[model samples]
Target: MAKSVAVIISILCILAFSGLSQCHEEPEFFVNGQVYCDTCRVRFPTRISQPIKGARVAVECRDRDNGTMTHNAIGMSGDNGEYNLTIKGDFENEICEVVVMKSPIAECAEVMEGLNRARISLTSKNGLLDTHRYANPLGFITSNPLFQCTQVLAELDLSLD
Candidate 1:
């Protein structure tokens, strides 16, 4: 009876210590980003940024050594054009990028070259203590600039000078 009691106590102690260890474990990393529609067709986001809602975005991670893909996760922008992606697993030796997948709006369906994908670092090895990484805002360009875009661009140019 005493031996059984001792064994039970040992098991309980192990479980207690394991639970304590988990309390200090590192949390999963999250990537927060935004998507925008180039309303003025300026090829870049302006001060009057039009956030694209329901835009599809994805993060692709490639193995640094062999250049093979390691992970891919997709997410959609909310009403405010924001997305929060949870990256699973450690990608210490991987190159990650956020790419524009698709645009929900018909007018902004074309993905502009050079502005489509933004490279991001997913691993915490960069000396960042926080588990959240913010990627540069990705955007979609319209095939044709809006009629009011000319006036807006002129105003922007005037403000710049």
Candidate 2:
């Protein structure tokens, strides 16, 4: 019966199209960064600075229009202050940032200006071929300058007069 065959063919075609659509599902991203202490309180890392182990970091995606949070994932820094966080979504219309949530070192837990968060783009539409996106290092300032910081700064021409 031609009618029976037609029905079966139509069902097969529907299934094929659905599978094609599923192939275009959102892609995932690997965001990497570091969390460290600015021992000299200069808002940047120096030779005297050290990594903050066990620091809590997070990747947050927000809607650009209304500033509503869309997605978020947390990660922890290793002993070397490195973190690799995986976020699953295609955020072409959202703004994403890597923020420092907590520092394991109590003495160096104060977030410094312009060094607390790093903005990143998380969409494939941009010509960036690498799935791994690097963020600016997020850091906190230590309560007091380390003893070796004076020598480190002097070498870098950042010492006090």
Per candidate, the number of residue pairs that clash is 0, 0
lDDT of each: 0.84, 0.90
**Candidate 1 ranges with C-alpha deviation above 4 Å:** 1-27, 158-161
Model 2: pairs clashing at backbone N, Cα or C within 3 Å: none
Report how far residue 67 has shifted in candidate 1, in Å.
Answer: 2.0
10 residues in a row with least lDDT, candidate 2: 152-161
**Tens-digit lDDT string for candidate 2 (81-143):** 999988877899999999999998999999887789999999999999888999998898999
Best-fitting candidate, scored by TM-score: 2
- RMSD for each of the candidates: 4.8, 4.8
Candidate 1 yields a Cα-based lDDT of: 0.84
lDDT of 1 by residue, 1-161 (tens): 99999999999999999999986665578988889988776678876658999999999999888989988999999987999999866678889999889999998888878888888777667888888888888898877666677667787774222
How much is 9 displaced in model 1, in angstroms? 17
lDDT value for candidate 2?
0.90
Instruction: Evaluate model 1: give its TM-score.
Output: 0.79
